[model samples]
Target: MLVIGTTEAAYMLGINCQRVRQLLAERRVKGAYKDGREWKIPLYKKMVDIIPGTRGPKGRWRHRLQARPTYIHVNKHIIDSNRNRRENQPVIKVDRAKHSKYCHEVEITGPCRVVYRPHQPLCSGAVLWIEVEQSTRVITKLYG
Candidate 1:
């Protein structure tokens, strides 16, 4: 399983470290443990993406961005792979106010990986991100 530190979990969860620990303790997040020096948790990159936000897959992360955006999505079947979907979609962080439709806080069965790429107002009618699924780790890229 992929393990992450408290800081990383907090960053992905879009909250402070304290909150992350609380979530872990409460079992809101699965596979979390307290290390001798600190707490560690199993963080699936995809989980963070489903958290309702406009920040593209990178900004949500506290640290640096990965070479390619990485995260998992449970709604893989829902994605229409027949057409040229978001496969080569570029990621950008966006403001929730800008794209309320996609930015709304929605509940998901599990965390699915998604990159936050805020679309430029000049580029289109709304500010949203292009989502794509990572089939394998080799093809997937972790954000921060």
Candidate 2:
């Protein structure tokens, strides 16, 4: 076990020299002692064994991104209208329900197929239907 200074410890730990000194003062780093003005920290086999500090709680920033629309409303008439449209088709937002009980507005885009007749004005628990096309390579691999 070789002994190193604060600068070398900071480099190995991927932290600033000031933070390393602060950790030494807080007695967080094990087997580290102050010799007059300089501090000598003992090198360990792994970085995890060098410092045993408790981590902070997980952040809630990712929860914001996970927040989705309560309802996903897909209309047959809207898809029919855009069937002949160009590549850059504008997404239409549904505000009022014409056939279903749900009236909460939600934006819907892309092609969709009706799997079941009862799944009108889809809610959180509803099964969504999205149309997809099989590529030439995938078709050959499966059926060729």
Candidate 3:
């Protein structure tokens, strides 16, 4: 008798945790018992061998599950309106040698490209740069 909880028993039996609890209530697993308030359900391999069904995953990867947030609790809403508007805007370019004529308060967006050269704003070999709001950065991860 391999004593275990309903959830563990469910995994060994290839069933569900709730179903294992049901079987325990029905006295299906001979040696199973509930000893604590919230938990303390136990089972054995012999009990699991008689149950039926399938396992979820073979521990090949990790899984993260979270409850869906209500619409009112959304963190950030990226309006697609600005994304398309940027396509029609004009591109701004200036020679690196002529950057002294430019101002820092310039509101630039859209298809602008920069030609980087020595003594220019770019410190790397990059010939182009873009300005974006520091707070608008968003990252996402998905599992399927």
Give per-model TM-scores.
Answer: 0.33, 0.35, 0.30
lDDT of 2 by residue, 108-138 (tens): 3433333453556245333443322211000
What's the TM for model 1?
0.33
Ranking by TM-score: 2, 1, 3
Q: Rate the local accuracy (lDDT) of all candidates.
A: 0.41, 0.45, 0.36
The segments of candidate 1 whose C-alpha lies over 4 angstroms from its true place after superposition are: 48-144
- The sequence of per-residue lDDT tens digits that candidate 3 reaches over residues 27-122 is 656555566744344434234433322565343211221122111111111224325564322222222221212221243232333343445544
RMSD of each: 14.8, 19.0, 20.1
lDDT of 1: 0.41
Q: How many backbone clashes does candidate 3 have?
A: 1
Candidate 2 weakest lDDT stretch, 10 residues: 135-144
Error of 3 at 127 (Å): 41
Candidates 1 and 2 compared: the better one by TM-score is: 2
Rank by lDDT, highest first: 2, 1, 3
True-vs-predicted CA distance for residue 42, candidate 2, Å:
0.4
Clashes found in each candidate (C-alpha, N, C closer than 3 A): 17, 0, 1
